[model samples]
Target: CFYLLFNSVLFSVLSDVELRSYRWLQTMIFTVEEINRNPVLLPNLTLGYLATDTCLSEGSTLSAALSIVTGQDKAVTEQCTKAPNVSLFPFFFCAPHLQVSYFASCACLSDRTRYPTFLRTVPSDAFQAQAMARLLRQMGWSWVGVIYGDDAYGKSGVQLLIQELEGSGVCVDYTEVIPKSHALEKIKRIVERIQSSKAQVVVTFAISPDIEVLLKEVVRQNATDRQWIATEAWSTSTHYSAWSGISLVGTLGFALRRVDIQGLGSYLTQLSPEEHTNEQLVQNVWEEVFGCKFGKEMYSGPHCTGLEKVEVQGEAYFDVMYNVYKAVYAIANAIQDIFFFLPTYIKYGQSKKLISGVKFTTPVGELVHFDNNGDPSASYDIINWHMGAEGKVEFVKVGQFDAARGPQQDFQLDLINMENRLYIIQVPVSVCSESCPPGTRKAVQKGKPVCCYDCIPCATGEISNANSRECTKCLERFWSNTDRTECIPMLVEFLSFQDIMGIILSVLSIAGATLTGTVLTAFFYHRDTPLVRGNNSELSFLLLLSLKLCFLCALAFIGRPAPWSCMLRHSLFGISFVVCLACVLSKTVVVLVAFRETLPGSNIMRYFGPAQQRAGIFVCTLVQVLICVLWLVLAPPLPTESAGGELGARVVLLCAVGSVIGFSLVLGYIGLLAAICFLLAFFARKLPDNFNEAKFITFSMLIFCAVWIAFVPAYVSSPGKYTVAVEVFAILASSYGLLLCIFAPKCYIILLKPEKNTKKSMMAK
Candidate 1:
């Protein structure tokens, strides 16, 4: 009995994969040789073997098939018997599917009539197509390129892959054909297309030779950084491994599940000339793996004595080689069962039933069985091409793809550190363009995808926060940060006592109050002196007290505004100045009337005496108090916030005066009283210099009027806290004018010239 094996491709320069298949062929031979030696199984007969390369073409495959059928290229010492033809190669899966195009009568492998003898240990290519689709989806890759050779195997597999890919959420950006012949110019154009296109990731479905040609062009074009999703067709091929400069660094692909046969290493360890000298296949494998020549012949290189070890060489490529080992055992078990259980002769179609669903346990403790479609369930490994020294490659299994396990659980990739020029531990980028960050909205280009866009900043009163796709308008109560990335509570802005302006003003106001206190003390100490009693002494005392209140009113303007402070700010200002102005009016009148009475026999002092002067001051102050009460009852000052002022981003907290009429009345009343006093004092400016206070009072009233007149326009135009600041400044300026102008002369004389303080010295003028 004999078993014949056929492989699709073999090249000396690109023969690592071809050599691997040859190792698998050796495994099949070793299995038969072991069985022939065993006493319990196939003891009465020995199994012979013949394996050949088909070169991945119809001509080569047909030629190899014809050679096997004609019984040529066989050793003369082998047994002469007809053997059942069986093929378990993975590459042959698409061949029978594409044969319907060549021959119209031929159906696919759906029934036994089209091809009765087709059987395989490896699953069909259909499972691989689904696996590719599911793998791309698991990685969130939707846009990609499809690259395949223009052959029957390529056409059939690509068609199935496209069907599965469409069922998933993926779309192909471009599909290209690799020429059957070695056309360098055509391949160059394809590589240039790949470099210029927008797609950064590509999916390849081609054989080793086609993949090698395309990858070499990719190296020439220096498109090494692009992601490549390799199919099972070329993922495990070692042809491109030694091309160290040709970078395939981050290539993700599907590979066959690996297994180990028990005691296979020990069985291969005892290869020597003492057992078999005529085994030319064993000698060739030993030379190819160990890099040595065999026998005692004189040669240019070192020779193997057949004493060389071959223990682990077969296990190194177990992913592919294990299939052949399983296939041999599958056939052996089927034949043994059929020969033992039934009397039927073992034919090709009849023997396939016994092996279809046979279960066995591998040395790795994994259970293997086939499904109803005459194919095993999908169990592919997700592998990455890791680069090693001296142009070698190591296939690392980073994930797995199993159809029976469902999509979500099946394709789980190990998170790896995919490095770039600027960042480490970054995910591999696959896109037409990068995404827009916060504070910007995406503006799509005319003909590009939505992913490709320009970023635009948000408009006023709006913000885009933390990668937001659109801008949102901010509420009136909230404001945006300077970066426009987030919203924050607005600041309460006012001239509070904590501010620098407030602090400075507060200190000045307290000092002014203290100074007023000092002056009041001085006056009290000299209450009965002639200078203190020069005017109606009661009126003089009242004016000083009113000025003290004016200085204290400035404190109300310095603090954070509340209802009480707001009302008191203007009310205290109005009433204090009115009291002071009443005192001035009374004194100016008294100066005129008293001088006239001295000139003649006038009796006006009796009619308008000290009591009448006090009445005049009382009536004037009462009028202002009435106005303030009415203003408060009608439209009182209330605390509020101001937006859209000179201060951006700060909302001013202010005491908003409710009525224009009330504010105007408050200032107008003070102005009228000052105007009357100014007129009265100006006419009396020529009174006796020694006893006259009219000139000083005249100048003081003039300054007061000028200050109030200017304050009206300034107060209306000033913003929030500044409006109050203007009013406070005007009050201090006018009060200081009255304080210094009307009293400095009296203090100077009383302190410096005490003799002039007598009543006789005052009357001479």
Candidate 2:
């Protein structure tokens, strides 16, 4: 019978030795021992447990625990429906008020899936953040900087602090991101940035590594004049000596600990003799069990061994843990006796549910019964780490608060002044002065008070409204009048000579593109020369058509808004420039290939077979199509409303052909092609060959590519009328390349060699 019971037990509580600090393992061990001794309605059975040494370094111990618990299944069914009891219980002893995510992966929180079963002993992390905010507000610190690790812990803490601060009329002066690895170089950079920010109070969501790096850097840089605050990770025995030794002594830290005596007594009464021993107590427990000495053994960071009030201001941390233990027992008791877990409607009628409501009176106050979410009606302790009269490290419970109330009402307590402590520093409160008056800006800081500063009224072209910090500039259609006192419309008078200049330029660009396209077409169809040969002619014609389109589009882009003008501007401006650029690129590649083929032993020439050349043309055209498609997808066609009504409705929806990256790449590709083409043409020109027209084509493309490349900077930087001027320049430059490259030679032969043309014509007649 003894062997059967022993083997049936899944856990064995061999020795229950509670250190001053009840870590996750110790908490579990204590609970198991208490349950075994009391025989909580179990069918004549007891459990044993074996405790081993584990480090608190990261997730090492959690990984070990998960491995040990694998494949061990001893079913302990509470309800008759037969769910495994061990599996049913997901979690136990959580720091409920500690909502910040720093210790999310610790062994204590290894099983998140079992969260419902996992009971939290303390409040959520939000509770701690809210408490800190209230404390800051009470102290009248309006502006603060936060330096947190770049992880879930730091981010969540920052969010809570931000929420708390914003409501209290405080603004975040700076937010610093510190990596978990705590690289000294990275920390040094962050520290330097923080020092330059001129922040008075620094709140840190850092682990020990981050803290050590930050503190060392702060002290080294003499940036220790400001205050330092910490989160829960430093609330254990590990940080006490190191923190005390550091130049930073008066720094405030936030963590969860059980200091309720009523809860502690209830917990002890329920435990077995082994669990109830001196080892199981808070400070007293550690010295007896481990035979290791600590100066003032405290549960959380800020309490001590003696009742000097100088060391520990309040009750021990045993109280908080004890309250948690009582809550668990109450919940378990209700589930067994009254079967209070049974619901009104059930699949199996009249069967008890796994969970039940719990209510308990804790030492702090009334810890009301929990609802389904396991929300406890409890408050949090605000503790401080300070050096005592004995010159030893100690924690003191300075204040406590309830987070359930409204922002203004929550955590209202007198702050314990720790100005004498080493880590804490007194900082002057910052005031967010009222914004400069509507008509002026902060005028040369006339003195200390904000209202004493001077102000300047808005200029004639600008107007200001209430609640606006600065004046608004007027539109381009109107300008300030001569008086410089008020704005008036810009009077327009019909001008005849200005119109003549615009007409002449428009006609010239159109004539050049049209005559060039016509001449190139005639040469391709009628001439026997190889200059007229090759598939490059089709691409040349496309370039010619795109150039003509640009000329027409520019003409359409004149005057105030019109729908027809808007559509033409977007379609022709974006489409024509792209296609023309593509054609120039194709011509450059052709010239490079021709030179390569002429070279003695160049395999590069072989790569550009007819198929490859055709593929190249297809790729270039496809790139232009993709650019248009991107514009269609990203920039919606729907016209945005304007301040000026119907006249402004017609917005020029010119598609930005490429983003900066795309723009740079396209330009680079064209530049590279042009460079190769010109280099080859230069060498080819040295041979005083007949009709060296390829040289003109090569040099023309080099000039064209350089012009387009330079256009990017000019077009991007140009403002107002200058932008229109640049667009017109681009239109002329792109179209003229085709005229110069394809039609110039034919034009020269026709006009310069007139006698040869006439003689050929007479002979044909």
Candidate 3:
């Protein structure tokens, strides 16, 4: 006879009797009877099982394991060919006997060195932890609370879960352990923590019993707002579902993949005390399931009718029986392999080696195999607890997690249900902070997890899209939009004709030029007049033409700067100003020399003739032309873009002075000529008569010097198109000064005061 030792939490010793555990016990017996009936697999072998009530006690479990290893139990006889112990309880003690577990999923049991004789049909908690972590990440539940039972199973599973959560952006807000003693005070404290935590998602890693105790405390406090994540240990257990109330609604969990056993329901329904009169466990189950006792029992319950039928209680209750069935079939397959393939008698320790290597398909077409760690392939059905049509809690299959597929493709949700499910429609938000929107980035709080953060707006020149962690800088020629969500082409800015300032400056430039033309017309109409001749008509005409050019040149600076306009504007202004100054200087010298000649026979009048005056003006103007020519050839100004102004949002299009030295020389030469003209004309101011040309020239030169002197600082300090505006203002001011001071009086005397334009009036003192 082959002996199968069945250990479970039975007889209601440490806790209340669990009907699901009773069903597991019956499932083991049913599988054993079925295997013995099969002739082709184990022809002459008959298998028998020894059931032990562990009462969920560690000492009882250890004692059962020791009895199997030492062969101390009277049930183990010398005729027994093999003894493979199948435990439905979590085994912490190691032994030599091949112990196969139906549901001991603790990851530490996978260590082959410590538990070499141990094999399990259920997957290890390591894979479950990974599956849980993946599910949390996929659901976007970054901030959550964790509550685990204070045992090797809970501690090991939580440790694995936390390890798997590293770098996954999932953070635990609080972790509390439920005491195994089921202390009310400790469980209350855990409930208090859950109530106080801001995390709306709480993960419970515990068995059904410990979870039941904790859930009662939670209900006592009425703390049911949280979305609970359940591990496989109690995710589908009916023990808690009975009393969990509406609190378990919207709870999501992972459960072992369920499979149906053929004829197992019929086998359970046919169970009766008459068939198993010697089996006390069968009587206890019948009494518990039917609420009746047998043979005048001590308890005050009704007697068994022997006609009560056993029916499947729930899907979860029946699903776990499949693991029990697989455990027995796995041992049977190993024994058959050892007898048929190896052709050797199975030794005491050799059974585990054969079982570890056995690979076969079940009658239900499911493959049964184990990895090197003696664990089956990890696969889970995602369950969502929601109110059913009957207004009771229902576990709805919503997704799946298969470890055979790669990590990227392992977890998947049923799209049809996920989209239409009532609980998922609102999709409970469990994060510590809401996701940052576009135009903002996440700023993690100090001394807090990454999930706890603040959303900060992007800087002026930077941008951040939705869910961005950091701000991105815009390109040099680009600028961020007002919302900082995207980069846009920068606004190109210059003194364009369309701008208000440009229009004003342009109007002023044209008005100045038109006024200069009117003045020129007046001078020409009075070309033979004494005032015109007295001021030297040829130099006066040249000065008027140069002033007109100066006024028009300001227009070049008013428009969008280009290569041609950039070089032309500066050169024209420089040359025009120099010519106007030269004409003034020549007139001043001629006036002073003529006055000296009148005092005594000075002979200076003959030396400072018309030809000499014209030659002097030509020479001075030529010098400025030569300087402008050299400036344009060596390092000419060019139109360029500058990033400046508020937030650098505008690209200022302006002409860049390629060579500072050349530009400075142009202004310096003009300043030098003005200064000389101003000094000479001041000296010649009081030499003669009514409207002294030298006095007018002196005032115009003073105005020119002051305008250019202020222009230097204003040009250097002004920004963007304003700099061009300042330059244009300076040109118009100086040109208007020269035109008004030098020519206004001449035009006044010529047009309005014709008597004062006489040669005799000009000669008067």
Model 3 C-alpha RMSD to native: 4.8
lDDT of each: 0.68, 0.49, 0.80
| Error at 378, model 1, angstroms | 9.4
Candidate 3, 539-576: lDDT as tens digits:
88988998999999998887778899999998988888
lDDT per residue as tens, model 1, 1-765: 644443433333243334555555556666667667767764575666555554443544565555655766543212112211212232331111111110010113424454443445565567777777877766666567788877544666678888887646466767888886648899998888787767777888766667778998898777776678786655665645556344776677877777766666565555565466776655655666677876657788887776665555422546665666655555555445655743453543455455354556533566666554445566787777765444456666777777778865766666452222112112355545455577777676787545456778876556886435688877886776666677777777788788787777777777767767777777788899877887667888889899899989998887788899999998998999999999999999999887767646567688778889899899999999998898988998888887634324667888888787887798889999999999999999998758588998998998899898899899889876787778777888898889888887877777787888888888876
Instruction: For each of the candidates, give the backbone clash count.
Output: 4, 32, 0
Model 1 lDDT vs. the true structure?
Answer: 0.68
State the displacement of the C-alpha of residue 197, model 3, in Å, after optimal TM-score superposition.
Answer: 1.2
| Lowest summed lDDT window (length 10), candidate 1 | 98-107
Query: Compared with the true structure, what per-residue lDDT tens digits does model 2 show for residues 1-765?
Result: 111100011111112232322333343445445654665333354544333222222232333334335634232211112111121111232121111111232222323344444334445556667777877776666567889866555677778778777646556777888765566798889888776765567788754445555776777777765666666545433333333354455566665544544333444334232333443234343333334434555554444333321222112344434443454344334334333334452445532123324454432464545444444444665556666666555666666676666655656443535554433444444434443455443442454333223345656556454323355665755544333333445543211125453455567666766775677566556444343433255665665676667666666444332344444455456656556655655555666557546556767866666567567756765765565456445542322222221222122323233244444544455455556555655655533323454566666766666677778789888643344456566667755774676457645655565444343432342
Cα lDDT, model 2, residue 611: 68
lDDT of 2 at 256: 59
Best by TM-score: 3
Rank all candidate structures by their lDDT, best first, as comma-separated numbers: 3, 1, 2
lDDT of 2 at 648: 28
In model 3, the Cα lDDT at residue 273 comes to: 81
In the predicted model 3, the residue pairs found to clash are none
Better of 1 and 2 by TM-score: 1
Q: After superposition, how far is residue 299 of candidate 2 from its true place, in Å?
A: 31
